[model samples]
Target chain A: MKNAERKRWCLEHAGEPLTPEDEAYLKEHPEVRLEVERLALMAKLMSLKNHEEPAPHLETRCIARVQERIQSRRERGWLYRLEDALTLNSAPVWAAAAALAVLGAGLWVTLHTPPDAGVAAVQEADPGMPPVSLAAVGDVQPSVVQTSPAVDVASADREIPLNEKPILFLRMESNQLPHNSDQLIYGNGGTMPVRFDY
Target chain B: MIDPHPPDAAGQAEEVTDQELVARAQGGDLEAYNELIRRHHRKIYAMVYNMTSNKEDAEDLTQDIFYKAYSVLNKFKGDASFYTWIYRIAVNRTINYVKRRNKRAGLSLDDVDLGIERDPAFLELSARESPFRECTLTELQEKLNKALMTLSEKHRTVVVLHDIQGIPHDEIAKLLNVSSGTVRSRLFYARKALQVELSEYAP
Candidate 1:
């Protein structure tokens, strides 16, 4: 064997006797034998070094520290989970805020807009009043006035007055009055008379 | 009424397999883990002590290693033996710690144990015709530790693991995450370096 390999083998197996190949190599190269012996001695010395005794409380202290770590982790479990859930990539918080904003806007629109405005507009468009000519009032018989749906023909027939100046009878119901006055009007352009039906 | 068990109960407890204890410890059994600590703490402390040569640092590092091992016990797959896994942790932690310590200060040797003179190897060496026999045990230990500190961290680790700790090359390779050939080469060079450093003591 080569001298370097022989020395390495000797150092590696310090307690064992050299093989015939190593003995032959060492005999041929006595210079490397001293080096091998020194390494063997060093290894023996290193092995003989005493094993140091650790502190008596080392195990207890370690166990206590580990327990403390485990307990602290348990106590902060929810906070850590919450933090993980609210990370920027998750988007739960932003999604919830957006949903709340949409619901609030819907509630505001539902509260402020009147529900009966459409019905009021339809009523104003077709008020159920029939066409009546002032000149034909005298010529109109009760039967002709009865054909008008909005006139309340029976009430109109009893109130019609025949005159050369053609009086128009406009009936105002108590609920329809803007100023809480229930009155009928019968008159010409400038001079008018207010007649209270009640 | 308290029932008395045999006094050898602690001795029997020490005989439990590392795998059994590891299983129990993984299930949150504190006693099982403490038993493991009792069994292996000495060897682990010795390994770190040899690397650092400082008893206080070795004690603190040993505690830190056990605490870290317990914290990550669940991650340990049964592929390696429990002792091997713990050994890996102890070695790696000590290596990192030594690196950080090296940056701050030079290596220092603690007082040698008085019992070293009684060791069989020391007696055999003292009987030889060498300068090692001339110095006192304390002086020899200090010189050996100083020589060890002179080596690079990688070389020192290989030597400690293979030569001092008597770990097999294959096992040392696994712990170091290197091939067995690399471990052998490193061990060879490390021993060669030590032989050169301690040549005066050679016969």
Candidate 2:
């Protein structure tokens, strides 16, 4: 039999009657005898269970301590509860949640906040520039825009300094964004609000 | 008003299960929790004491573990037996404490030697004419405790639980969260090391 199997058998049958086969195995592996002797000593030690009989009233004292802790826990219950709420046991989970919230807010602001930086600066820098009405574009016919054979880039570009441009005010109440993505008709460059004729 | 000390009905009624007591305790029943403590405190205390070899540390730790179990009783899902749950807590916390303290002054086997004179099992061995028939036996017991101290906490824990505490190998496996084979292997190695260390006091 293997050493482990022999050890297992000897342990299982320690201090009990052994079979003839087991006797033959132990006789052959004399080294396992010390293991069996140690087993006997352990059994003797096991019999002395009360050797460590806890100091009298250990249970009563421990229970008293538990009650004290529970009482204290109750007395400062709110602070204990607040600590529990803020205790970051799962740091990664809270970190991921916080990161996702910040990312979502950034995306919302980017997608919803109007591109008003240039317009705001233009108004703030030159408060006297007359607010141009978007309705004025209605008077300039579309044909006039089409009939201009080739636009003079220098004149359009020189008419306004990059920092000093007129602001156009348009009023609409739809939460739905208008599909005015055709930038050629309504493009604004930096502070300059491109004129529209339509 | 709740009874400060409930009757020992749990002990008298064999059918009163730990699960039932746990359920009651979960509903803010302190009396039921007291019964649970009555049933398991000694075993928990002994396990901690054996691991730490310090009675004061064991006392404090046992109280802490019981109170911890009470504080977190609501989280007990009742899938595993409460004994297994509490034993696991006791073993883990004791092992952690042992590793942190990393010192030894244990078990005072000297006390065991003095206590076992009246024990029938030791009497059987004492009946034999042995070398220490005239000795104080304190040195021998001290040697034994020192030998036990030589073992790593993991090895000593197996010996303490299985041999001294009379816990079975399978239950120990569950409590230590290890395999049965691992438990047996550890016990075998631990017993062998201890025997070799104190061979002069051999049975």
Candidate 3:
């Protein structure tokens, strides 16, 4: 190649492994040789000038960051393990069987419970029953249930409408209790007798 | 006749193998990963700092590169050296970052953040030397960087990789996923551009 072409080739291949032909051309052509030498020198100068060490704190920061990522990966690994264990192929069929057992027990309890008379009374009341005070509406028969003046004072802070019927309260165990018992509480406004120790 | 056996052990020991370190790292050796970083961090930083021209962004990008490498350690097949793989990641990320910034900033290639006149290191160099103080090499470097900015990212990256980092063209091609011919042509144009820009630096 001519000088200009050889110089162009040298620039093009600045950091490449030189072919024997290009090496021979540079040996033969003084101008191409000078250009090659200058390019190498310039490359070295630029590399030296721009060769920067990473920031002093980068190693520590990178280690900390990598450790943080590793910790996250560990946490994620546990989740993945859980996923694998819970997958259809990996999980035992016993879990489904256990779920069926609990559901069956729930259904059994729901079917066996007898209906309450107070509940049936409230539920199937002669719609014509006289509207009683919020505190006086209860399990006692209308003939025996007296509206004492003292009862109104205790629950007076709440507005208990005269027309409201007392609702039966269920205990924590889901058993129905009369609203008047101290253990069971009348909510909104109906009273019924329910007895239990606090 | 068999070719004379190359000196294997000492030649191999002279340079740290990224594959070995990566395999060890994947096997849960944290120190191996640290060694990997120690071996490659400077080159990675040089690439980032040249692209960013700011230490802060360079440091952040360097961290991102290694963090990404660490996260994907299991996926690294030995087709490329870990150096080439991470270098490609760094370059691709930087190019994407610049592209995204260009989209938002509406800035052209000529307007990359090559930093300002008062960068402390360059300024310190300026203050200490008489000739450099008279007409600072930092100023000259800035001028060169500005000229570099005028080139497309592809060409500028070629110059930065081949010229500034002294990385070989074949390895650059591997990292850039370009033909060696393409590397050669781009390098020619990049050097020509740089020479015209840096002519004053030559005696």
Judging by DockQ against the true structure, name the best candidate. Answer: 2
TM-score per model over all chains:
0.61, 0.63, 0.51
In model 3, the Cα lDDT at residue A10 comes to 74
Query: Can you write out model 1's per-residue Cα lDDT over A83-186, one digit (the tens) per residue?
Result: 43453223676788789999999999878856433323333454552333244434434553445343212224534433333323433232243422332322
Q: Candidate 3 chain A: minimum summed lDDT over ten consecutive residues — where?
A: A148-157
In the predicted model 1, the residue pairs found to clash are: none
- Top candidate when judged by TM-score against the true structure: 2
| Candidate 2 lDDT over residue span A12-37, tens digit each | 54554677877778888777765676
lDDT of 1 at B70: 78
For each candidate, report its DockQ versus the true two-chain complex. Answer: 0.19, 0.21, 0.11
Better model by TM-score: candidate 2 vs candidate 3: 2
lDDT of 2 by residue, B121-176 (tens): 65765665664344454654555556767889999888888777777778888778
Least accurate stretch of 10 residues (summed lDDT) in model 1 chain A? A189-198
Interface RMSD of each: 4.0, 3.6, 7.8
Each model's RMSD to truth, in Å?
23.8, 11.8, 18.4
Give the clashing pairs for model 3. A166-A190, A179-A192, A180-A192, A181-A194
Per-structure clash totals for the candidates:
0, 0, 4
Q: Which stretches of candidate 3 lie over 4 Å from their true place?
A: A1-7, A10-45, A73-198, B1-20, B29-31, B103-134
Look at candidate 3 and tell me the lDDT of residue B17.
65
Whole-model lDDT per candidate = 0.65, 0.64, 0.59
Chain B TM-score, structure 2: 0.80
